[model samples]
Target: MEEKMNSGLVTSSRKKLTIVDTDVHHGYRAQSDLYPYLTKFNAERFAEWGFGGLSTHLYTSSGGLHGQRVDFDAGEAGDGLGTIGDAHYCSTRLLDANGIDLAVLTGGIAGAASALPDVDYGSALCRAFNDHSMEHWIAKDPRFRLNLDINSQDPLGAAAEIDRLGSHPAVCGVMFSCGAPKPFGQRFYHPIYEACARHGLAVTMHFGSEGEGVNPPPSAAGFPSYYIESRQLRPPAYAVHLASFIFEGVFEKFPTLKVAMVESGFAWVAPLIWKMDLDWKGLRRHTPWVKRLPSEYLVDHFRFGTQPLDEPADPEAIKHIINWIGGSRTLMFASDFPHWDADDPMMTLSDQPEDLRRRIFAENAIETYKLSLPAISQAA
Candidate 1:
């Protein structure tokens, strides 16, 4: 079945899926349209930061961060490694185009998700990006929602934006990238977490380059010189974010704050949380401010996306992650969609245990992102 919109468009009626993409990088694809709103500093900084052989077509000039273009054939339109162009891609090309339902819009831009300046400039750009998404991409469709990517530099500025933007009917939550110089445990991001708790907006952290704007040679770690080493570093960022919240007492401060660690593989979560619990049990004397075990804090406060699945991802492995992280409820499913690395959405879900099918596919994401179905009757 299909439903008709006020705009005279028809979309899929399937309601079992609600994709809340946490690691999107589409901003690089739309940079030309967004550049006019960026400050002169953003443009100048972007060029100055380019290293040899990495001449970029998309990036803010101020920090040479928050932007990178995707490559695709002219005929592909917004179809790149992992992007679908605009609302059409979400509704038509992918979901309706594939018999799926509901989509939560997030950025595919690196810089937008990075620790750019502070939350002030970061928040302004976020508003601009959301405005652009709603007007040009979502086209006011209630089903296609947005999440604000906040700068970790200034948590207060981020908090202010979350208060302002979270109230906007179109926004679903706030996003925090993990690679900032400030380790996640610092007090720098508390205000943003506080704001999210107040507004009831979910907080998201995606896995990727921290956009430190610096490159590391493989020899530093004695790892082989290959592009994969760069990618391996992505998952560690999540641990940093988790450690920040757990050790810093952010969760204790705002118990209701909902946080989701996206794009990072779920496999490591179980072991990491175990290690965290052990560390906290012994290290509590070191940081007397923390009132509980870090593992207990994570099980209560965090959620992880299940994608970039381990090769030979056995049912036992999936089950083990669930058990380690506390339960099946903490695992949410995602395709990572148009990115070259995205796992096949269908294959990922199909492999799950029968009892876990519904919760992982959509139910958990709805709770994590705080999105309601709009009551089918209400949609009409």
Candidate 2:
């Protein structure tokens, strides 16, 4: 297969602003601490079944996981360390190196780690991972932010764990998987929303999963098998979640809770949302329980990231998504940094007119994450 050609430099003279690297995989730090704890039982059992553990899949590119793959060549980007550079290539590093006011570090690998069935062993590993993150990645530097990856299989238990750590002040939200239950709905995951609501924390549903069977695996009936299936799964999942909350009354159940869909490209937002609202109006009698348009419920509850944007990169699509979601106020910018094909972030608004750029890159995150400027001001 031919390698993708990297795009030209992100051309813009616009001043940089605080950026949040919402999706990151801290590989070396994770490998050091996470590798040793995998019990021989888990490792051996996985091996017996032709299954791979964190060590095999995540640490090695030949395996399916790609944490190491993305960083494999970042060193040549001028940051020194190979693929995985020191702090600068990491989220916290970028925050200091760039004018990024805050950083939210998330894991695409840890979700898979939590899915392994060791129960006590698995959960223990989860704690170790979070503790490692808190101590090394987040605590090592003061400005970086951390969001707990709440493994979805046992959300209630996960929620309790989140509540226990909720007071940490470093963890700002819980990250749930897209299509977590095969079909999406918050009912099975209410405890998480409850805990988050009680603690005034936000909930982020990030795209991609490493086959943690908390929910049923996806089916190809209407889905594709490639990675793009993951993208296809998101809109429908969001639709189900929104429908459940509207029809099943989740927001009424918990007034303060908020959710953000991370790494879910915004291209589908317009048409999907329009279909949702239209269906709600035209098909209401089928589910009289729902009192509002799906669009209304969604605007109040969801925030979407601009990374992993769909293939076309059409400006019209972006505008449509923003308009359908109740304006540019509903979208947030994300770098998804260090990952292969990561939006250079600087390019997020480069092609757009100035006003839309400001809304997506800055304003929306402030409103959604409830971010506030640091007491010590920095260059905008």
lDDT of 2 at 239: 52
In order, candidate lDDTs are 0.58, 0.58
What does candidate 1's lDDT look like per residue over 148-233, in tens digits?
Answer: 75655666666776776678765667766555666665676677777887778887777533443332221336333444555576
lDDT of candidate 2 over 30-100, digit per residue (tens):
24444444566644543354213333222133211253335345442311111233444563344543445
Worst 10 residues of 1 by lDDT: 59-68
Off by over 4 Å in 2: 1-16, 27-32, 35-88, 91-93, 96-98, 108-110, 117-119, 182-186, 210-214, 222-234, 237-239, 285-289, 311-314, 353-355, 375-380
The segments of candidate 1 whose C-alpha lies over 4 angstroms from its true place after superposition are 1-29, 35-82, 108-123, 214-224, 313-315, 375-380
